[model samples]
Target: MSHAGLFISFEGIDGSGKSTQARLLADHLRGLGHDVVLTREPGGSPGAEEIRALVLQGDPDRWSARTEILLFTAARRDHLERTIQPALEAGKIVICDRFADSTRMYQGLSRGDLRAMVDDLHRLMIGMEPDLTVLIDMDPTKGLSRALARQTVEERFEDFGEELQQAMRTGFLALADEFAERFVTIDGGRGIDEVAADVQQVVSTRLPS
Candidate 1:
């Protein structure tokens, strides 16, 4: 799992603006002449993208908690193998919209008390962690509202309603504590430019010169 490049992942509840910030960071880095690979979970590589449609577009109860953990892990493994690892090995900066941490929150804690199972599978299958994780902390209510407004087919998670979003916010904050070394919390309620500036500053400190 060791590589010559930096691996960064973004984690937050639905509507936390993590995806937009991820893209903004990629654009900033690339403009600075850094080689960057911008990707997302559940559908980064072709194989993982296929699995994404299965897990993200169905009913809220489409897959049980255990089943979801398996599917997300499968997609993550493919993403790592096909997209993430290659870029990292080539010494490129790999910025992922979401990663195993998303699975930990969405599948591990949201549905049931299966976090241990999620961690076990991750250690066994995806034995790596991001060098830095930017957590775009936002109010669950506001985040959920922003998320629903998108009106995309990937609304299965959002369909679970605000209660789930509240729990996810709490869970993600707790996770930031659990893995504080790599997690940096940022207030995401600000304007896009403000948030992107903070993201760039945090990441610039860690990027290789």
Candidate 2:
């Protein structure tokens, strides 16, 4: 947890409803008058957005795991420098949709050699990370169904089939097990109000009180 201001992040497999839940939580906090900066990874910065497109383009079958990992890292570097750092420095509560943890799950867990990449990033660029990370845990199949129902394949990762996405979800859980200090998994298979309430409670209890 952060010593002073709140710096929280949300993580999940694609279609885990992180963005929706993040918005709900941020809205709840703002209702209480806290300054909140709600944003997403692979974006939230000009440079990162470009990298995001590159990372998410084409068919999932055509993309390599190493390539996915590197693209994620590149986008993260831009986001940290351009969006996250500035907001945290201003003492604002930042609720990022995803952070380095996504890379850990997607690249390291799914692909290979996650430790080396994660350590390098921690050592090189990222200094202060999220005070708390909310992992929206759900069946990847269910999530993929929901996501696909809404969109028409905008990117590569988004195009991954349900089985592969389920594997990705397991990877995310492995990250939570290893880094329990910062990761809090929430059941996102519940009703929207229930999920939002859980997120709100987690933030209120964890944030400065």
Candidate 3:
């Protein structure tokens, strides 16, 4: 779907610092006087946020892969209706920390080979892709370490262990290749400021003058 504003999403394996970069980029763009909306998947709008708690904060086996695709798609649908589409229609930059790509990895690839199902649901329910996607590439082991150190209730994904992280990193890089036109891969193994600087530079090129 096309819109007047830019829809940018950040994707990465666990602890790739995509969330931090998304926030930093939003702040940077807002400082430059662009109307910006910073949001996240599974929990952007109130309804989606409720779904987030259900999907993100439970046992690793709490939801089956098929069930998760449905939940995530439902949450994404609510988020799109309540937050994303409106912001873009108003010509605002919407920076989402995570989006369908993340689900494509976590639920679609992580548990089993359900990517086709995820894509089908996405096409049926959420027929949009970000104008740009910033992928923060990091070492799976290091990223998992950083993620586990956070100790948040949302660690169900991380709780799946480093193997899942490894698979996710590989899957994300493949996704980047699949969607090369809209995906910009950035090394996230550097300092926060360094990664943020690269992110800002990439995004600046895409934003309106």
Candidate 4:
């Protein structure tokens, strides 16, 4: 969170409707006359986008855990430098689809007990956290089914299957508790309109556009 701008991030399981909710919030904020910059992780800047393709498009096991962490850190550093920092400095609202939290869950939790490594890299390279983080919580089984319905070339992470996804759901929930200062949990099991309303309420109450 920066004093000059409102930085919001959305976190959830693969099919927990986080992406959709994040977009709707950005639109709603824009309608309220706020300058909003909607972006996604692993590819917000040009360099990060290049890293995103490399990290996501290949086989699931293409890179070892440590190497993958390095790549993600590189992307995040570029994102912060090229896209996020500038937006915040200009006093615009930045709504990111994901941030370093995804790295904690995906690379650290899923691969092994690499949480410290993730935090260390983030602290060293990209030290800022979102001003507000909306964690859309949902049942892992349901989320996985919804995720599988959509087919994409970037299915490498999804290839890890439901068990890991369940773990991820728990990990994210725990994170909300750990980082409660900037976290809000939304029940994404509900309808889109309801979820959007809840998300809007949370953001408006905190940021007011």
Clashing pairs in 1: none
lDDT (C-alpha) at residue 155 in model 4: 77
Worst 10 residues of 4 by lDDT: 200-209
Q: Between candidates 1 and 4, which one is better according to lDDT?
A: 1
TM-score of each: 0.99, 0.91, 0.99, 0.97
* lDDT for each residue of candidate 3 in 32-137, tens digit (9 for 90 to 100): 9999999998799999999999998989899999999999999999999999999999999999999999999998998999999999999999999999999999
lDDT of each: 0.95, 0.80, 0.94, 0.92
Per-residue lDDT of 72-99 in model 4, one digit per residue for the tens? Answer: 9999999998899999999899999999
lDDT of 2 by residue, 108-175 (tens): 66666665776577557665668889999988888988887776546476675777688888888887
Candidate number with the higher lDDT (2 or 4) = 4
User: So what's the TM-score on candidate 1?
Assistant: 0.99
Whichever of 3 and 4 has more lDDT, that candidate is 3
Better candidate number, 3 or 4, judged by TM-score:
3
